[model samples]
Every structure is written in structure tokens, then in C-alpha cells.
Target: MSTKYKKLILSLILDAIGLIPIPFFDVVWAPASAYIMTKMYKSKEGKIAGILSFVEEIIPFSDIVPTFTIMWVYSYIINKEKVDTIVEA
Candidate 1:
């Protein structure tokens, strides 16, 4: 698969694994995944640092939505671009 797809899948898997289920995983996964995504995302594509900062600002619970949305956006963008390229080619 493409590097973008790999990155998306890896991030999702890591985020899922990082979750602790009951006690508190939001505490750990928020920062961990945010940092991972911030550093890993294509700099030209999205506001990675800004997203990370937003997540950081809210702490654990706050990150829950943005991170997932960003990942989805990443995957969507990549796939959409691929489809467009294929159609043009």
C-alpha cells in the first residue's frame, strides 16, 4: 500500500493499542498519538502542529475527536487523490 495508507493504518492501530479501556488511556494516548501524528503527517498537507496544539490544550478527553477526525481526513485525502490520479491517467 501507499505510505499514506500505511501511516494512517499504523496510527489507528497504535491509537487503539494505546487505549487502556477502563482506567485511563486518554491520558496517555492523547499526547502519544498526537505527537506521533504531528511528527508523522505530511507538513504540506494539513495543519499538523495546530491540530496537535489543540489536542494538547484540552488534555485527554479533548483529543478524542480531533485526532480521529484528522486521521480520517488523512485517509480520505490520500484515497481521493489516488482515485483522481487513476481517473486522469
Candidate 2:
């Protein structure tokens, strides 16, 4: 698999693992998600995603949405060029 797919899968897996019913799993997930998000796209959107991923995972009960995966899909699948164009604008 490409590096991008690998990152997406890893982030999703981490998000899944963060679902374990334990305290402070979000703390671990947040930074990891942020790193993955920043690495994947390396644009303004990616930086924002990194911050949002951290925030989303840190909030209680917010991990249910899989922000990293959603961002990945949106950036790479749903509207890849849009992110670049918007970032460059």
C-alpha cells in the first residue's frame, strides 16, 4: 500500500484502539492523530486537521466520529484537489 493508505489505516486503527474503555486514551490518540494528519497531507488543511483531531479526540465521547479517517477520506478520496486549491488560495 501507498504511504497515504498506510497512514489512513494506522490512524483508523489507533482510533479504534482508543475506543477501549480506559481513561486518557484520548490523550494518547490525540497527538498520534495529529501527527498522522500532519504527515499525510502537509498543507494548511492538514495542519488544521491535526489540531482538530487532537481536540476532537481529547473531548469526552468525541472519538466516535473518527475524525482522522473522515479527514483522510475527504482529502484523498472525496475531494483531493479541493484541499490543495483551497490551501494555495
Candidate 3:
């Protein structure tokens, strides 16, 4: 499979793992997720998304946001159009 699809799958798995309702789990998972997000995406956008993921995971009841999946879509789909347009210009 391509790296993009691999990233998508990984993001889904990470989002799923984040949804677990274990009490105080965010204390450990939040920072780890932030680091993973930065590593997975890589760039200014990745850094921003990592911060958002950390905040989302840290906040109570906000882990359902699916930050990784959203970032994947933003990076690969939404942002791709802009890059393509720039290249075409």
C-alpha cells in the first residue's frame, strides 16, 4: 500500500485508541499523541495539529474529536489542492 493510505490507517487507529474512556489516561496519552502527530505529518501544519491534538486529548470528553483523522484529511486532501494549484501556476 502507499504511504498515504498507511498514514490514514494509522491515524484511524490512533483516533480509536484515544477514544477509550479510561480515567486519567490523557495524562499519558496526550503528550504521546502530540509527538506521534508531529512525526506522522511533519511540518508547520504538523506542529500546529500536534498542539491541537494534545489539547483535544487533554480536555475531558474531547477525545472524540478524531484530531488525527482530521489532520490527515487536511494534510492530504485539503492542503493538496493548494499545493497542486501552486505547482500548476
Per-candidate Cα lDDT values, in order, are 0.51, 0.74, 0.85
lDDT of model 1, residue 83: 33
Better of 2 and 3 by lDDT: 3
Output candidate 3 Cα RMSD.
4.7
Q: Which 10 successive residues of model 2 have the least lDDT summed?
A: 80-89
Q: For model 3, how does the per-residue alpha-carbon lDDT over 1-89 read when each residue is reduced to its tens digit?
A: 97778888999999999998889999999999999998876677788999999999999999889999998898778888543322110
Sorting all predicted structures by TM-score, with the top scorer first, yields 3, 2, 1
Which pairs clash in model 2? none
Measured with C-alpha atoms, the lDDT of residue 18 in candidate 1 is: 48
lDDT of 2 by residue, 37-70 (tens): 6876577877898898888888898778777678
Better of 1 and 3 by lDDT: 3
lDDT (C-alpha) at residue 21 in model 2:
69
Q: What is the C-alpha lDDT profile of model 1 across 1-89, one tens digit per residue?
A: 87546656765765555444555655655565656555554453334643564465346544334454455565466456633222110
lDDT of 1 at 51: 57
Best by lDDT: 3
